[model samples]
Target: MFAALAAVAIFTGFVDAIAGGGGLVMMPALLATGMPPHFAFGTNKLQSVFGTTISCANYTRGGLVDWKGNWPLAVLVFVASASGALVVQQVSTRILAYIIPVILLMMVAYLIFSPRMNDEDAHERLSRVGYTPVAGGIGFYDGFFGPGTGQFFTTSLVALRGNGLIRAVGNTKLLNATTNWAAVLVFALSGKMIWLLGLSMAAGAMLGGYLGSRFAMKHGARVVRPLMIVASLGLTGKLVWDWFVS
Candidate 1:
């Protein structure tokens, strides 16, 4: 079972590194281990931390991440995510279920149809000050639901901040790492994680993350944009299904 979980983690890490729907893969796989849903969520977070950290490191070393400009956003993401987790129990997620899919579909349409959307950076629509709120809001969304946080971050950077695809992906990894670790800490404190299972999966995730990052680095926007589009569509489909089914 552990070996099988690790294998799934490898693939999840790879898809997650390139796009951002890793949870779409990892969560269902974890549930198949017969773990309780809460424990699965916690364990998934533990393994995801490893994968995201590796991807972030790879992006940083490749000079794709804007560390100096993005550190503040990372910090904000952590805090905002933590706060969102704390407040989640008090709020109904039905609103998000209805709204997020629409937004995600809009993002998909924009990415698909926008002629100017390319690998190259363009003029910025939002300044650093404007981006702070955006980062904080997305971080909160990650903590609260977290299906397509990576896609959201990448899209926002590319469309709003005028970043190239490669750079947007790098920054997305960093912010994703921050939010992931923040949620992991909360889950760890609640004693929800199965450390043995999570660590085993992490081993696989680390390797997958490294290889995926390398591929993204080599392929640039050609790979990332299409994956982003797929991920966004997938997320939208899932959200719509859940909303209708419920």
Candidate 2:
């Protein structure tokens, strides 16, 4: 079971490195091990954060991250996500979950149709400062509830910041990595993790993240844009299915 899951972790990290829906694969694999749902979610964070951080590092190393522009937003994202984690039990996110599929579907359509979704930077529609509120909301949503936080961040960067798909994805890794730590902290405090499995998976995820980010930098927008669309569509289906089951 551990070996199989480790392999899944590698693939999860790869996809997550590109477009941000790693949980789509990892969560189900964890659940199949027969742990409780909280354990599954917590363990997911425990393992996936490694991939997120590794992917972010590779992007930053590739000179794709705008440190001066994005650092403040990263700090805000961390705080907002932690705050959301604190309030998660107080809120019911089913309504928001229902709304997400719609948003993801819209994102998929835009990705499929948009002509400007390339690697070259374009005219900024919203300044970095103007993006704080949206970034905060995504961070909060990731901590409080999520199936598609990566896609959300990537699309926002592309559509709102007018970042090309490549840079948008690179920065999305930074924001996505920031979003994971708070949830991991909350889950650890609550004793909701499978440490042995998480650690095992983390190793695979780290390798996968490294390779995936390198691949993204090598291939650029042609690869990332379609994967973003796939991520969005996959997430939309997951959220919609969950809504129906719930």
Candidate 3:
């Protein structure tokens, strides 16, 4: 079971590095291990930290990440994500089940059809000061529901903040790592993680994240944009299915 979970984590890490719907793969796989939903979420977060951290490091080392400019947003994401994780322990996510699919579908449509979409950075629509709250809000969503977080972050940066696709992806990885680690800390305090399983999966995620980040860096938007669109559609389908089944 551990080996199988690790295998899935590898694939999830690869897809997640480019697109952001990695949880769509990881969560169901964890649940199949016969863990409860809360345990699955917690363990998934533990493993995801490895993958996101590797991807963020790759992006940072490659000079794609603007650490100095983005550090404040990263801090806000950590705080907001931890708060959301704590709140989620006592609340139902049923409402998000209905809402997130619509939002994801909209993202897919925007990615596919937006004429302004391009690989290069454009004129900024929102300054860093204006985008901070947006980042924090998305961080909260990640902690509470967490499906297409990478897509949301990437899209907001590109469409709103005028970042190029590659830079947007780099920043997304950093922010994701922030929220993931923060949520993991909260889950750890609550004793919700399966340590052995998470560690097993982390090994695979680390390798996959390295390879995937390298691919994204080399190929840029030619690869990332299509993957983002595909990931968005996939997430939308999964959420709609879950809504129907529930």
TM per candidate: 0.94, 0.94, 0.98
The candidate scoring highest on TM-score is 3
After superposition, the stretches of candidate 3 with alpha carbons farther than 4 Å from their true spots are none
lDDT of 3 by residue, 74-101 (tens): 9999999999889889999999988998
Cα-based RMSD of candidate 3: 0.8
Query: Mind giving the per-residue lDDT tens digits that candidate 1 earns over 145-181?
Result: 7788898999899988999888889989999999999
How many Å off is the CA of 105 in candidate 2? 0.1
lDDT of 2 by residue, 92-125 (tens): 6678878888988888888888887888888988
Clashes of each: 0, 0, 0
Each prediction's RMSD to truth:
1.6, 1.5, 0.8
In model 1, which range of ten residues has the least summed lDDT? 84-93
Candidate 2 residue runs with Cα over 4 Å from true position = 90-92
* Candidates ranked by TM-score: 3, 2, 1
Candidates' C-alpha lDDT: 0.87, 0.87, 0.91
